[model samples]
Each structure stands twice: as C-alpha cells, then as structure tokens.
Target: MAVALTPLSIPGRAGQLVSQLGDRAELHDVYDETGSRVYHDVSVRDTHEVRELVALVRRIPGAVLELAAGSGRLTMPLLALGREVTAVELSAAMLELLSERLAEAPERLRERCVPVQADMSSFALGRRFEVIVLGTTSISLLDEEGRAGLYAAVREHLAPGGRFLLSTVDIVTPDDPEAAEAVPEAVIAAVGAGGRAYRMHDYWPAGADTRTVTIFPAEIGDEGPVTVCTTTVGVLPVDQLGAELGRAGLTVLSGHPLPGAWRYRDVLLEVGVTA
Candidate 1:
C-alpha cells in the first residue's frame, strides 16, 4: 500500500549499498524485499486477497486491467484463471520480478499476462476493459490533482458497465478528537528472514489537513541504527474520497470495509453515464 524507500544497509556496508545500489536496486533492496512475504502472511491470517479478487473477476466479462500491479501478485492469479490481464506497473524492478514470476507459470498462463511499465495517473493503453483495479491503497499515494488525473484516466479506459475496484487505508480527521488520539504509536510493518524489522509511524504536522508525514525506521539485526525513510502522502477520509470520485464522474456503487482489511475499505464504482 505505502512505498518505503530502501533502508540503510547492514551497518558495515551501509555506504557501499548507498553507492552501489541504483534507484531500482534501492527499491528492490528495501522497498520490495518483503512484498510477497506480507501477502502470504495476510492470506493466512485473513482473506486471501487474490482469491477474493478472482471471485470478483468471475462475475465481470472481458479482460482485466490492474493499475499499480506491483510484481504481478494479483495479475498472475487472474491470468491463471484464464483471464487476459494488462498489468500497469511503474517500477522497473517490480516489472522484472513480475516477468520472472510469469515465466514460471504454464505457457497459457504466461501468455495471458501482459506487463506494461507506465504511470497509472497518465497511461494510454488505447483499449478498455470490463474490470479495472487499483489495488492496496495506491490511490492514497496521490494528491488531489493526481487522484483526479488517475480517475480521469480510469474513466477513459473503462468499458461501458465495467467496474473500478480499489481499497484505501483510513486516515482520521481532526474533527474526531478521540479517533485522532487513538493513532498508534508505532506499527511493525514488516519482518525479514534475517531478523530485521521495519517499523512505521504516522504524524500530522498540519492538523485538520489530510496530509500525513510517515516515517519508516528499520532495525537491521544487531547492527547500529541507520538513516530512516520519510514520505508524505495525502490520506483521504472515506466520505471525502467518495465525493472526490463523484466529481470525477464516477458513481460509488459500494463502499465497505473488506473482509480482513483491518484499517482499509474497499470501494466499487462505475462511470456516471446518462442514458
């Protein structure tokens, strides 16, 4: 859902890592290291997201287009189900991993997975699909203008009667003093095989504003502390998000907390068309 920058290396080689690791390597080394592991953990404790998505795909006709389809986690399974999928991913490293994963699948399955490296906010595939999905809080990463651009692009590429599915993490508003105070002190976001732990914390520098400054600090085994990764994102409250999409000419069909989503809500929407 949230993108964390690559952490400082294993202490001794910290400088080497920063020097040798390019942007893509930095992304893979830290940001992407635990991508699949988290998915596996969630599938065991909660709902298998891919399976739930597969069920949804079964009801819709035509091809599937997944935005921000990192490493093809969802796209691969959709392809395995004999559905054609166009995966839009921005990270080259993620696309590479996705390609490697697809290669291991059966030929028929591999053939159905189309990987495209493009920004979701402004991608032109020149085709429409029955289903379009922006998975795992990808929408929250954007500002108002970016969100509008993404919705416009999605609308442009959505076929008649097609559905747009997405999930967003909850962001508390200052209007609710009690809920704002309930924000966690820290969350253990991920754990690696080598006993490393990635921790995340959120704070509001500008109260009442949806903008949040998130800090991700990691502990690499017993090695000394390293530099932390910081990112700022606009976290839209649920009702406000729905209103924004409505202004984009999208009608919210359903909005509810997904089974096992914890703090996220899944929304289904359709293009507002006048008959």
Candidate 2:
C-alpha cells in the first residue's frame, strides 16, 4: 500500500530551534566537515550541470553575485573562469570555509572572488550585479513570505538588464509508490557521510507541510550512540514559486528541464533597471 502523504506543521520554535542548533560549535563543526565533503564530491557528480550553469551565466554580460554561496563551490569555479564573483552567504561556519579556500586560491581567481556574509532575504551590499544566482535550491530554506522578500531584494539589487537564475527540486508529482519511497531514500543517501546518516520518519500535522529529518551518527565499532540533528525544510510548489517571483516584478525568461531529475534545470528571471 502507498503511504499517504501528510502535511506537517512548522514548530512555533522552528526558527529559534535552528538558530540554537546552528550556534553549537560541535554541531557546526560536524556540519562543516560533512558539507565540505559533499561539495567536493558534487564537483564530480555535477560537473556537467555546473558547466551548464556557467555557460548560461557567461552569456550574460557583467558582474555576478552568488546568493547563499555555501563553501564557495560555484563561486571559486566561476572566479577561476575570470568572472567577477561576489558571494553572499548566511552561515559563519560555511563562510569561514569559503575564506580559507579563497586564501589558497590562485591570485587571479582570488582577485575575481569576494565573500560577503549576510542574510540573503534582506541583504544590501551598497552595490548591484548584472547576474544573480541562487544555487542548489538554497532559496527553499525560506517560507513563502521570506521567499517573496528575497525576490524583492534580488530585484532591488540587480543592475540594468540584470538576470536571476534559480534552481530547485520539483517535489510535486503524481503519487507513485516506488518513486515516493525512493525520493526520501535518495535524499538521505546523498546527505549521509562520515559515518552519519539521516532519515525522514515523519511528515505530520496534515496542514503544515513541514518535514522533520532526523540525523544519526555512529562509529564503525563500539562507539555507542552519536548525536542526531533534526532539521526541517519548507516545501513550495513550482506554481507558487513562479507567482512569488512574478510578484517581485520579474519576467520569466526560461524554465528548462534538468537532466535526470524531477525538477527544472533553472528558472531564469529578468528584472529591468535603468542602471
């Protein structure tokens, strides 16, 4: 029998809870280590995808800004391509890793890349860019209101003829038993590393659409139980996302299909400004 999908609720303490967990040094350390590993591995699996993104950006003329530029994966590579890249990220730990990577980056690449730590929803850098990219579904971290605010901010910070490129997973599909079961399993496998694993055992409250992912870390032998970190991600449908972007005063340029995925390759939006 197919497991009926149920809506989940965001805890009243959701934001505070994430804030508290993110503040813990030990937890942060583990996340940092795991994230670094993931990105390093992603470069291999997604090289073609990354190349496609870079090719698209290369077609746009001028400076580029990377929103939620975790660990500088795209930032560094774009910089190496001689593009002027400014990275904006929220996590201090991730930013620290980006900074460290920048220090060891080639001089030419370092000259092209700059890192800025800030909240993407309302960040203002006293400057604008011709191209803005929110990579790897990072925008989904925000709620509807927050997503709207972020789109507005992106519009506000775009230069004349500037374009925005956003990517995300499309989770809305005809209910299929095997596919649904595989979706969560694939996500868990991708995120599991360093002897740590995560599983989504609950999607509850039937109205909230909130998901609870439980993390479990264990040693190879006799290390007993390790810590578990639970995080929730907000779900937004493609139509809702498009409507939100439109509300922010942008025109859709393209919504391309991503290869081997149930999502769009990229949703490209253009905002007109007079420089």
Candidate 3:
C-alpha cells in the first residue's frame, strides 16, 4: 500500500527530538567479547522473529527505518529483500561492526543499507518511512517515559498510513504471579561462530514492578566466561501499550503472535489520521 505523509503542524513546538540501557563500558565489553559477526550469525539467521519481520516488510513497498538495529541483524536481511533501510543504533560498537560487514557486501547491497549511530528514543532523519520496525523487543529496554519518547519519534518519522511493528517476550500477568517472580536460571541467548555461546539470566525485580532485569553471560570461543552486562526494562502489558500508542497518535491495526516456543509476539500500528 502507498502512503502519503505530510509533516504534522504543532501549535507550540518547532524543533524537537527524543534519546540506551546499561553503561558504555558494560555494553562495549559485552559486544567486544561477542563480535558482531558471531552475534548475528547465531542470534539472527532464520529465527522465527526474523522471518516474521521479513514477511511483514515484504508486504510494504518502500523505505524502512529499523530501531535498535544492533549489528545489522535485521538491517542486512531487509536490504537483501531490496528495501532501502536506514538503521538507527545506539551502541557505537554495534554500529562499527555493522559498517564492517556492510563494507564487505556487494556495492548494490551496501548502497541500500544506511547505518546511523543514534538513540532510538530520539532521532530525526529529516524524513519519514513507509515502514518502521523495532524488532527483538528493543523497546522493552526503555522505561515508561522513554517508551513514550520513542513512540513520539516513531510517529514523527512514520508516513501517513505507514506501519510500525515491534515484538517482545510475553510478561506473565497477575493470574500467574509465581511465573513473574521466578527467574530462569539460564537460557541460550546466542551462539556465535565456532560454537561460542551467550546465555541470558533474569535477576532482580522479577515480579509486579513495571521493570525487570536482563543479564547476558557470554562464552567466547577460548576466553571462557566474560563479565555479564545487565539491562533493565519495563514489562508493559498489551492494554497499557495500546494506551501509550493512543497517546502518541498511533493506533494498532492488528496484533499477531510470532511463531516460537516462548510467548513471543509483535503488533502492527498505523497512523490513524482521519481524512
């Protein structure tokens, strides 16, 4: 479907923008320990989430803006599908790795992928996109205030009729308080080249709070165990999410659960401007 996006005119605001989790040192060590190449090779590839996102993009013909495009996992794939993609990433390490990989691609493919080092919450590319995607539940990394900032940014960059999509691991509701409190000991987070592995563990605030902890424990090929990086994020329910979107002038058109063993899912939001 074709979209026509006209910049919205606000009464008071003339210029505005919005702005990651964990400290720089912690993020750098984590990504350095697990090279971007290995991370993409293991965590991305033909995962259910990636496939679902690809399918969604195929339906929309135009440019795409991918938020939190860590290491170009989704960016490269979308470019392969002949979509012009602008990837906004926070971690400098991640963007550096993405640039390295993109440099190796054929000129035609490389030209289509634009790598921008910027925070997802507040970035302006001076244009709108036909499709905007926030895969890997990256939005979960933000608190309530930050999420609103992100939604506002998305709205500003989204073309009229453009679609916004995102996914996350389901948060257990009150019907299952036990499920929310118990933290999983270890789960395979990623497996890089040469069988290197990354494990994830949930630590504190596992219940009731709008926030929770996510720690990544990586095992490099020969380095053994490296220091873990902890990221805190909000586990917003669907109702709350819908309300947030509404507040941002975005509306959910449909919601679909991605194919996976875990309760993983994504939602489609469209700018609901009445003619």
Candidate number of the best TM-score: 3
What candidate 3 gets wrong by more than 4 Å, as runs, is 1-42, 172-186, 204-225, 260-275
Let me know the TM-score candidate 1 reaches against the reference structure. Answer: 0.70
What are the runs in model 1 whose C-alpha is more than 4 Å off? 1-48, 170-184, 192-231, 260-275
Give the total clashing residue pairs for model 3.
2
What local distance difference test score does each model get?
0.61, 0.60, 0.62
Please give me the total number of clashing residue pairs in predicted model 1.
0
lDDT of 2 by residue, 1-275 (tens): 11121122223232233334442312212224443443433332344346657877888888999998877777876786688999998877678778888899888888888889888988888888989988766776888777877877887888878888877645434356465544432223343423333332233222234554433332223333223334466655456677666666776666654454431233333334323
lDDT (0-100) at residue 202 of candidate 2?
Answer: 32
lDDT of 1: 0.61
Mark the 10 consecutive residues where model 2 has the least summed lDDT. 1-10
Q: Write the residue-wise lDDT of candidate 1 on 142-216 in tens digits.
A: 778888889889888988988887766454335656664565332436543344455544444324344332223
* TM-score of model 2 vs. true structure: 0.71
Model 3 worst lDDT window (10 residues): 10-19
State every prediction's TM-score relative to the real structure.
0.70, 0.71, 0.73
TM-score of model 3 (CA atoms): 0.73
The Cα error of candidate 1 at residue 201, in Å, is 4.6
Q: lDDT tens digits, residues 108-201, model 3?
A: 8899888898888888889999999988767777877788789888878888778887776554333465764453322446655456565544
